[model samples]
Target: MVQQVQEVAQTGDNSGQDLVLSHVTKRFSDFVAVDDLSLTIPAGSFFALLGPSGCGKTTTLRMVAGLEQPSSGTISIGGRDVTSLPSHQREVNTVFQSYALFPHMSILDNVSFGLKRRRVRNPDAMAKEALEMVELGHLAARKPVQLSGGQQQRVALARALVNRPAVLLLDEPLGALDMKLRRQMQVELKAIQTDVGLTFIHVTHDQEEAMTMADTVAVMNKGRVEQMGDPRELYELPRTAFVANFLGKSNLMRGPITEDLGDAVAVDVSGVRVVLPKSRSAAHAGSAVVGVRPEKMRILDIDDAAYSPTANQLVGRVVDASFTGIITEYIVDVPGVGMVGTFSQNLGQRPAAPGERVRLLWEPEFSFGLPGDEEPAEGTDAV
Candidate 1:
């Protein structure tokens, strides 16, 4: 089986090793690409560096792979300092977005090229075993042009894994595939990493890609990490406005804290009052920005009998509505507040059309608060 081949191929002394970057920084002629970033990637873990364009995610990955040296910092693998080591000396391999395989050579030869150069014994057998691990052994005799895009990508991955590096670096490896194929590759990549048990550090600008494949995600902004955690934690309880808006859609309202009720606090947005949990609030006093995801809000008729007296309510007129199969998306404009978005499930009940008055209601515990000074639009346009 393919799993057996992977298990045997990965039985090296440096199979699972921790990668550490201490005070890593990269500067290019006065522009700081990465500023004082530090991270600890555990052994045999899937970690992703996610951000928009020019956020220093790719630069950080280059530093780890020795393609670009950090201006000031140390990179260590398995507690050994490899900051000054060259690319060939370090036990690391990288798979780029472009499948840079040799067109003139067969798939087996392409994978065995590195081993052959190093004068390793039984290069053909080792390369064949690696190809089998990726379920491409049957196509070993075919050239790069003879395979599909997905198959070529698997070949590139097999080439990287054939070396049995201590760590694997993926630089937007699935960026070139089509949407449906990209989703398929995401699942395959995660399964391969799990079977091999190697430390994988992936860099990507796609939020969904990072969330779907990585066990932990670090969101970067302006050469610094805005937030880092598991996908669910970062989505449910964002610590900053950028994270709240970047990870997904959020309805943010700025207000002043009026009262602190031990476990919760009350804030006044315009003339309306809303309650936020103390544990979920980053700003305790002064001003704060309360945020709730669109899916957490319910758009109901103004005089609906299902309205709960204890729920936080806001009155607004539906500015726009779109029926998207399973859910109806609505944009409501409140008099004192800006436009707020909400998603209501379509369960046969008629949805509020445009120009209709409706009430937006949500539980207090579902809302999170960030510092008032943070820009609510920091990451709204990132996608």
Candidate 2:
């Protein structure tokens, strides 16, 4: 059966309301947290603000929830200007990592709190419906302390959704749960969002969480949006080294542009010539960095004879190999490319051992060029 959030019958359709931010910025004295940023979130979409610590993702979420005012920007929800509105007045709700449920209240009462505050008719029915949406209707009579972490999170979500807000802001709502439960909640949260038809703007530092749940992900850096698109697009065709490195692992090699093939470009990384298709090239005149995902490169015996001009091959010595049942991972030391990583599926073939000379081969199109050195920030990178 299809479940939906119990919006008031008179509220009508709200699928057309988009969240728009124009020239948004937030500064704290000498520090500028969120630089000039602009983005549009379509109505009823699952959007995510992803980044490392101090990247302004949380600050941006606060601005949207009316918890923090933007230094300079206009915020509108469903076509109404609410840049300066208070949190309670805006037609939005927030679910935090803490899952701040009242200890004294029963689950049913906790879920219905927002509705009762507004004096909605038949608050019990609406709260029960919201609980059902999260598959927690049976637990409504229990206290929050009696429920598990995942159960508590569902309650928090149910509370937020009971009022049928135009936008729902989630600030790392699953951060408190264990990794396994967190993954489980990610699926549940997405399903609830789909059933309810509400815009969900999520803020998370976990790359896997954002990639797993968000329909559109905006990667933020130093208070500015570095890139925004579908998760696969950002991962496969990262425009900046920060994005490429931050989103996931990438084998980046710095080199100079050796030739421009019109539809493709050749780069010399540590004396190794690499070809990349122009469609995905970020190659700049002089120097550039070529990025390829570890999974895209294959480890082959050095004796293989077949070679193609459109493919890149590097001779390297295996520095280390880790066999994790399903895949064999290798760290190879290429002469000009420094240390490179590759993953090969475990299909009965023996993995190369340390000290073995091997060949790393991949199609040219699997590589992407960036304009500069791969200088992703060190330490905890995302918020």
Candidate 3:
């Protein structure tokens, strides 16, 4: 199923696709926000434009929403060229981070506003059904300010979805919530998208959010998509160091060319040597960077180090340790590469203390390498 979708997306020009952006580029006076960006989102898929701020995730989304015109390239939704269409003309709706609700209007009224403006039949009934879809029917009488952040976000979702647009654009819709609420709403939003079978084109700077919600994740940098695939496909087999480091925590190692082992590019990173899963198409034997996620790395006691022969062990002195309930974060000092962190599940055993000598170990496949330390991405890398 995944392969079919991917093949169709890669080959399908404009037929039967929900959205397609070909060679999309956007720029301000001296800054290029999205450069030659191209992507296709399938119908009923939850797609995330994941990156840090200024990476053009939002800018790309704006182009899709008809809010921003790409300096070049075509933008299509439902096989229609909507690049130059006004936002109102596009069959897409956006749920903004600010909720964009009418504070004075009740929840049902808020949801019905768009339907009323479009003169949809039985606007009140549509609003009620939309509120029910979000499980907020009971609160439909309340005003925007009267609802919690989660509730307000639900109302915003209902408003956008009541019209049943072909695509739903979510631009950090939960960014304003507290941590706990944010996590809860992530599940809620995903559930809503699934239930409605709506194609969601969400943009966010949060890696975890993207991982949790997206069917396919696109990692962006400096106006270009660095890498993209399913979250696990990206996490377990990152094609580049940037994708590895950005998705989660990593102990990045850099080194000069040593050997090109057909499937893998072997190199010494500051004296430590480890073979990461190779992307034969992308690896080169130059200055290479390896990124290993912290959870994939284990902190072994000196006596236990020998037992971890399969683990790529790094020697370090525990500079700091913090018990984070679920896991303990340990900052360890490596000789030339500087400090790296490893996370230990707190439930396993009490965390090792600071100043203790330890070894961090992980399977060779846990890490990945790419062209080392290129110039930092300015307005395009993250946003």
Please list all clashing residue pairs in model 1, or write none if there are none: none
lDDT (10s digit) by residue, model 1, range 1-383: 55655643475766437999999999999999999999999988999999988999999999899999999989999998999999999989999999899999999999999999999888898889888888999999999999999999999998998888889999999999999999999999999998888888999989899999999999999889999999899999988888888898899899999998899999999888889899999998999999999999988998889987753789999999999999999999998888999999999998898999999999999999999897877788743
Ranking by TM-score: 1, 2, 3
Clashes of each: 0, 7, 10
TM agreement with the true structure for every prediction: 0.96, 0.94, 0.88
Candidate 3 per-residue C-alpha lDDT over 287-315 given as tens digits, one digit per residue, 9 for 90 to 100: 76666778888888766635646425788
Candidate 2, superposed: residue stretches over 4 Å from native: 1-11, 304-311, 373-383
* Number of the candidate with higher lDDT, 2 or 3: 2
Best of the candidates, TM-score: 1
Candidate 3 runs further than 4 Å off: 1-17, 257-266, 277-281, 284-287, 305-311, 347-350, 372-383
2 or 3: which has the higher TM-score? 2
List per-prediction Cα lDDT, in the order shown: 0.90, 0.87, 0.79
TM-score, cand. 2: 0.94
